[model samples]
Target: MTLTKSTFTGLVLEYDSGIVPPPYSHVFRLALDWSKGDMIADLVLHYTEREDLSEEEILDEGFTLNDDYNYQGPLNSVWIKPLQQLYEKTRWTNKDIEEGGITVTPLEKGKDEGVKIPSDQEEWQLMAQDLIQAIYETVKKEAPLKVNYRSVQGDEIIDCSLTVHFSNREVIFEIAGKSRQINWEYAIQLMKIVFTPDYHYELAKEEAGKKRGAYIDCGDGFWHELGKGVVNIDPSFDAVSKIRKGFDELISE
Candidate 1:
């Protein structure tokens, strides 16, 4: 197959449970943006042929047998109509479909190419640790709390046994895993105070679980730790009151 100017997108699906029955098993969707025209239509019509494959048959032919490339053969078994309704107008062209694992490059006459990683692993990890420390201190002094940490990338979610220590108006949260660290600083900033008793009671009820998982989990865990007196928070009520007083002073002036 002589693939001219083309763009390919890769999508990876990693199901944690591995054996999820029915619809839950369907994990991810990746679209390859084909630059020229509808490749799917060509495949249907048998228009393109593997005519001039070079010595490296696999590379020149532009196909791979790797699981990543195939991604369980087109997600057809699971994707159904209504949910999977793709009309001709809405249907993906050849350029839009991609195997989960294959990296496709597009050719263009005058296109600028640039690459950047979202964030450095080391920096994010350090920030995660700092946030963890802040959570620990705030809970310890104001609320009194204990916590365990867990993180995941790809399909592996591993637990990190974390403990916090504070000194010189500074706090630290430490964990052993890889050379890479967690983004604890942002985690701490994003933490919210939760009432554990309230959370437990709410979790027992069916109403709470219906909302999104992230929202409920964050709220429940945060308050549960708070109500249990397990962690301390800076800017306690007293501190907030003082800040308000200062603001009021400034306004009066």
Candidate 2:
């Protein structure tokens, strides 16, 4: 799968949430726009269980409970949105699967001459958008269940809704408005190698006495060129803690 900026943002958000889980039954969900990426982080409270308190009162109590945590901002920004209490939904996904779609004839690559690769930034951006669309279509058609994923990158990436596809054995993320798939296995493996329990994620080869991009830092920094190719193309240092947590949830599900 090709990793795009749009999808990258949600991965960031999810990673953030994992590093810090919600207070009890409370969960933080990021909002997404098809064109804008993520507009706000929504606070979903388990109101059904907290019947004794009013929403406003409950929120006030929570802030008093954890002063260090920030959600609502003084500036009233994208990082902060009004609190929303939502009830549990039923029948969003199906348990039983194995139903296939209509079989269609396959189309081979064009017989036309050699393709020209994009060398300019503008050309690459245009191509990235197209690639994102293609990945989205592939997942929508092939995967039985798809769900929305949000961002921890805050305003770093463009606003778009990202998605993940789940099967029995593994999971894949296409993400947001411009879809792109990445090598999920390779990404997880790389994350594991670089992740440290005490200090969290690192993008450096400490033994080498120098820092490097995560993609190349591992192997010859002893990184091998083998096995299904590269993952964590450019992971932000210290992000693996939360990102890996989110990854675990998806795989477990």
- What's the true lDDT of residue 22 in model 1? 24
How much lDDT does each candidate structure score?
0.26, 0.28
lDDT of 1 by residue, 1-253 (tens): 2222232212111112134332222222222222333111011111122344333554443443221212111222111121112111122224422221112222233232321111232332232233223333433432322233333335544333222232112223334443322343322332322221133433333222222111122322432222222332443443323322322332233
Q: Residue 49's C-alpha lDDT in candidate 1?
A: 26
**In candidate 2, what residue range of length 10 has the lowest lDDT sum?**
82-91
* Residue-pair clash count for candidate 1: 39
**C-alpha TM-scores of all predictions:** 0.18, 0.19
What overall lDDT, based on C-alpha atoms, would model 1 receive against the true structure? 0.26
